[model samples]
Target: METQEANTKKVVVEKKPLEKVCIICAKGSLEDVYATLVMANGAVMEGIETNVFFTFFGLDGITKKQMNRLHTATTGNPAMRMPGGIPFPTMLGGLPGVETAVSGMMRKQMEELDMPPVDEFLEMITAGGGTIYACKLAIDMFKLEKKDLSDEVEDIITIGQFYELCDGDRTQIIFT
Candidate 1:
């Protein structure tokens, strides 16, 4: 009898740790920016090389003028709900000053939870050795100069250069 059970071929690949994480932020909404910040900060804390690229409206997250004064999206947001989980009315969200008030309340809630503001969060990430970058194309499109960006921004580079930094086999590119 052929000893077929004695012959086996299998391949087991070793798992490799992440060497770097490149995060791309394309939206500037308060929630979107916070999501990117949380992910980048977490990766930095884990001792992984972290790089954040802010493009399109996401530039608002790093722009000196808008960073601290970001507002939560009120209109067209399906997740908006009342204190008791009642769906927030669409027309109510469009009312004047509603967004600002809601954003203020949200910020207050975040403060109570010890969540640092945008600027402070960026500082924390940088202090942990995470690098922040702005998209050159977006900067030019918005007619913004380098001085308009936060001090934490390492530089404004093109997508090509950003990809070069992401050249390692163990690197991951995440879009937030």
Candidate 2:
């Protein structure tokens, strides 16, 4: 009986390798936009087919009028800091020009590191073979047209369409 039990074969289940990724960018702030770009770019570098769908305020990252002018979220961002690396006080965020100042500082630091602006980042991601899409409902809600979006945008698609693009055994979806 013991020998018979030892003869039983163990079946192994292996997960499929990640072949595609769908990233959802839902915020418009500088940090959020950069996060999405970095991840999408990284996915492409890993030889994964990637798609980035921008919805809600995330549309700002792909909009021609706002792409390069995204602001930092000051009100509730605990990670926000000053040039000296001091934590930014929440109360100071309410002062006029404070948000702009912080945003300028962040932009300068990013520039020092040779990070591209939002528009350029989008261009880079697309050039690297990643696709960018805008949420159709979001476009309607924001009163935006195709002409108002960056040329990098592949299309404005519904959520169902986005899901369809992500439909695959080895596809992963990330919501930022």
Candidate 3:
């Protein structure tokens, strides 16, 4: 019985190598920007080719002017907190200078935690061979010109063009 059991061996098969492409369409608040950067970095570290297509509010992270100015969620957003567990007063966020304060505090905390800024993280991914694109429709909708985006942006692409670019022999499409 021991000899029979030993003869019943299993064959371990190696995983097939696959190429993956990610299309990160970030369109949420600052948290979304952080999440997108983190995922993009992870993919790059794994040697997976990646592309980030920032549109709408997501573009804030790539905008030359607003990249560092993004604010934490306020208003009816339940995720935000003020000086303490005390709910962030909706009216306070509406005030002229409070948003900046909140955004600054958040940025400071993130820095102390050693997290890279969004733009810098994007740069790291690009340096690691990841691509970045700006959606043409979003640019037009926001009245943004190519000059308005960061120098790191590779190109402004229509959805069809982006799809064509991403299609390949052994690529998997991932939309985040």
When superposed on Cα atoms, how far off is each prediction in RMSD? 2.9, 2.9, 3.4
Instruction: Give a tens-digit lDDT track for model 2, residues 1-176.
Output: 87666565333445567999999999999989999999999999899999999999999999999999889978788987776789889999978998988898888889899899988888989999999999999999999999999999999999999999998889999998
Give the per-residue lDDT of model 1 (tens digit) for 25-120.
999988899899999999999999999999999999999999988888888999998778999898999999999888888888888988889999
Candidate 2 or 3, higher TM-score?
2
The window of 10 residues in a row where model 2 has the poorest summed lDDT is: 6-15
| lDDT (10s digit) by residue, model 3, range 41-153 | 77888898777788877888788888767777667777677666888778877888877788788889998998888778778889999888988988888899889888889
Is 1 or 2 the stronger prediction by TM-score?
1
For all candidates in order, the CA lDDT equals 0.92, 0.92, 0.78
Q: Could you tell me how far off, in angstroms, the CA of residue 71 lies in candidate 1 after the best superposition?
A: 1.3
Off by over 4 Å in 3: 1-18, 83-86, 168-176
Collision count of model 1: 0
Better of 1 and 3 by TM-score: 1
Give the backbone clash total of model 2. Answer: 0
